[model samples]
Target chain A: MVGSDVFRAKFFSLYLPLTLYLVFLLFPFYWMLIVSFKPTNDLFDMKFSPFWIQQFTLENYLYLFQNTDFITWLKNTLIVSIVSTILSLVCSIFIGYALARLRFPGSNFLGLGIFLAYLVPPTLLFLPLAQVISELGLNNTYWALILTYPTQLIPFASWLLMGYFRTIPKEIEESAMADGCSRIQILFRMVLPLSVPGLLSAGIFCFTLCWNEFLYALIFMSSGSMKTIPVGTVSDLIKADTLFWGALMASAVLGSFPIAFIYSFFVKHYVSGLTAGAVKG
Target chain B: MAANARLKSFSMRDFFDRERNLGIMLFMAYPFFLGIWLSLTDSMIGRAGQFIGLRNFVDLLTDTIFHQTAKNTFIYALVTVPFKAMLGLGLALILNRHMRFSSPVRAAVMMPWIVPTALSSLGWFMIFDPVFSPISWLFRNMGLISKNINFLGDPILAISSVCWANIWRGVPFFGITILAGLQSVPQELHEAAAIDGASVWHRFRHVTIPSIKGVVLIASLLSIIWTFADFQLIYILTKGGPANETHIFGTYTYQIGLQATEIGMGAAISLYMFPILAVFAILLLIYLRKEQ
Candidate 1:
């Protein structure tokens, strides 16, 4: 099977195509970064090559930091994402354990139900959710996102946790039980420690979803200071009256940094979790 | 108190499922039921009015915007799902090959998907800028065209621009998922086919395609649901502009339901997703169950 022709075939097939795909995938982001740094004059000038920016500056970032509620939006997004992640993680841990460990009535159905809930698109849920949030006087508050985000997060987290939980040898739990550990004690000490990768992936998934969330954030958090990163960047930068390309690109780069960071840092866990759904995919 | 101690003594027998049930009830069941109920009633502005049966749905069926959005959403999904599947499979096949830099390449592959969609859409928005598009500049420089193209101003061009963004963002997801599938195909199948004097194309047709068929179906199905419900890219780049030519179901629902304060209609319009998504979800679960 080790053939001479296939060696060259692999290069042409794999390397060339990958390079092209990489360029296609990375170019938009590169363009964003280039535009963000390019001087306003250089940005518009057709004479200057569009691919590379000659004169770069922090003028756009400085303006973003100084002129707008960029910091506030960042803080709001952080708080919402973190709180929602923690909330869903807690809820999912419980559900995950119960579904994985306990022999309760309809546990199987409930597990499948949660998975289906995750399958349900946010479009179908957001309208009724908006009403429910407003009824509780949560509109324009961080709590609106905090309470609602768990709808998606809890299902995803619990499903992931359940999968992780299933992989640990049951004998380990039995030994812990023999060692006089309570149910919760064993879960906290043994299962939780072992499922760190799963937990991290679930948490990252939640944080990413929360940060990227636009529709609900657009609706609930109308206040100038309350927009999440995606909502805030688009509204604050791409206004009809303004249309500052450099600043807009700057806000986009800045807004995407945390998500990009988390995604890359936890790339392993994230990919595993992503492929779990896509295993079927 | 005594019962608690007794429970601890029989920990294996008496573990409570309270925590799990509570989470499901609040997060999954509540909104699910509320969604169905609100779709049936004349609910608006936080007030649940007397039930109006399928009036909202009836109105949606007749609504011109709803009709257009339904068509647009279908078109968007139909176009993107297959492209994402084929391209994803192509990348997956390549990446699945034994390579030295496969790990870094995998990470690089995920970049489009990693960056948030709306943020990337902003990048796209500028790249598609009528006067300053780099693609336009390149074409002009090559003497291919006289001037820049209006990518988002014309309806057909606008749809193409939005779908391009969608496809770009979606391909990585499909690629990795299909790559996972490709990796799982037993080597013996390919080797066996090769030993039978099968050509590379025959080996791929017999061994690769069959092994990855379920994964392709599921991946493309997921893409369909996401693309159909997609609000962000369209919202950020075009917002269904040029006379609402690019509006998908997601943006249309937001416009009518939330922006216009026609909550009943929005809820109803969104409810249409139930049948389509339910079909996909069931198919996925069935295949997943079979896999396990």
Candidate 2:
């Protein structure tokens, strides 16, 4: 049985610190939620408590939905995230398989190459890539994002999927090969089947990376209708001088909802993928 | 033996394995080389110019604003990394305990990181709003200060504000990765240490720290690299503003390259980030090879 001494130790060491950390983690979200619901007058009023909503309204949400091109931005984001993810996934699966299981020449070097590629952040590449996008006549089109995003995404996906592939028992593939299965066939019929979790984790992680991407989207897509959610929300919502706090916060909430929703369903897979990439790559 | 046999001759497997090479060449290699080339030239948006090797970089050496930005970048990384690493490790330790609602708590803890930085940063933007800031209001109400503290307006406060937001966003990543590292620290080792009459702190310092050392190093190196190249959070929160006090490599590159149409200068600024990051990348490569 727990005594008061043990209880006091647990409370101070565990509960108190954890609670404070959670508040730090979740307070911005709480503020966004409350601010999104408050009317414009209450939003600007200094007298009102920032914690509570005064005369809650949906006008901000309505403004986001109707008065702006939010839906277009959302659609644009979905298309870019999905198409690039699928493209990167197919390409990385082959590469990851090669590095993880194949005995090809220079596989380790190539594997190292892929890992290094992921570390090259977009900030360093956007300027030159912008010129490339323009030269290809893909600027202001979803293709700009769909094409360039893989520069970052492929490496990430390959690195993670390689880790996953290594975890599968090689004997399964050896047995399938004994049954007269070719390498590609063995990959599809045997290797891929046993690695569903890995595939899901890689796919989900790639999708989230694309979804959360900002710099390239902001630079590559300049038109209003073609912008992704992050770029569109920031560029459109905040006008000259005066900030539309409610609509901006609402956009922030709405923009984050899709990733948060997808993540809720795949938290375990995401965490595992994250660790595999960090620890292994 | 297998590698030697396979290395005897080129086969279809080698071709299949090189599948990602073409994409890598086209996407990553091309842009990377182009960025380097751009740094050597005085290229603008509409007009191409002769190669002006190292002038852009040399100009940045003397530029006061770039000096401030460089100093700010180092300050931001220095302040944020230690805080995030420490707090993240602390969080991982706390979460590794036997607790109720552990799954939900873990998920909630990851929310800030899971959400898009471009979006979550907006929430921070609101929280740090000068006139209507809840934090300033709370401080005033608590009689901690008499006047509203300008979070993003003052130069010193602006950089720290950016660092605070970066730490907030970054801690969860450290927490979860370190948590994964923590879980891998076997219970048997701790029990053995305890049986040897070691104190809790001693057991943790010896057993826990050594086991998770690789993870901690990899996570921190990655964090440092990412933080150095970080753009979205600072770009959103302050636009590197209140007079370029908060600009890092990313936002400054965007400002000069895109806004001013100084493509070559922008590329040079971004390439400035490479040498420092390359050191980290080399270390990471060494650690990863050792892991293998």
Best prediction by lDDT: 2
- Residue by residue across A223-270, what tens digits does model 2's lDDT show? 998999999999999887978899999999999988888877777877
TM-score computed on alpha carbons, candidate 2: 0.96
lDDT tens string, model 1, A1-281?
57968877877888889888989989998999998998788877888789997997989889989998899999999999999999889978878877777655666787788888778788888888877787788988989999888887888788888877877888788776766777889899999999888788888888888888888898889889788878888887787855888888898898888777666666667667765533632
Interface RMSD of 2: 2.5
lDDT of 1 by residue, B1-292 (tens): 4434433344333444456466556765677678788778876654567789998898788878778888889889887788888888888888887889666678777878877788889999988989879999999999999979999999989998888888899899889888777877888888888999999999989889988888788778778877878888999888888798988888888887777777777778888888887887888788778867
TM-score of each: 0.92, 0.96
Q: What is the C-alpha RMSD of each candidate to the true structure, in Å?
A: 3.6, 2.0
Error of 2 at B145 (Å): 2.2
DockQ of each: 0.55, 0.64
Clashing pairs in 2: none
lDDT of 1: 0.82
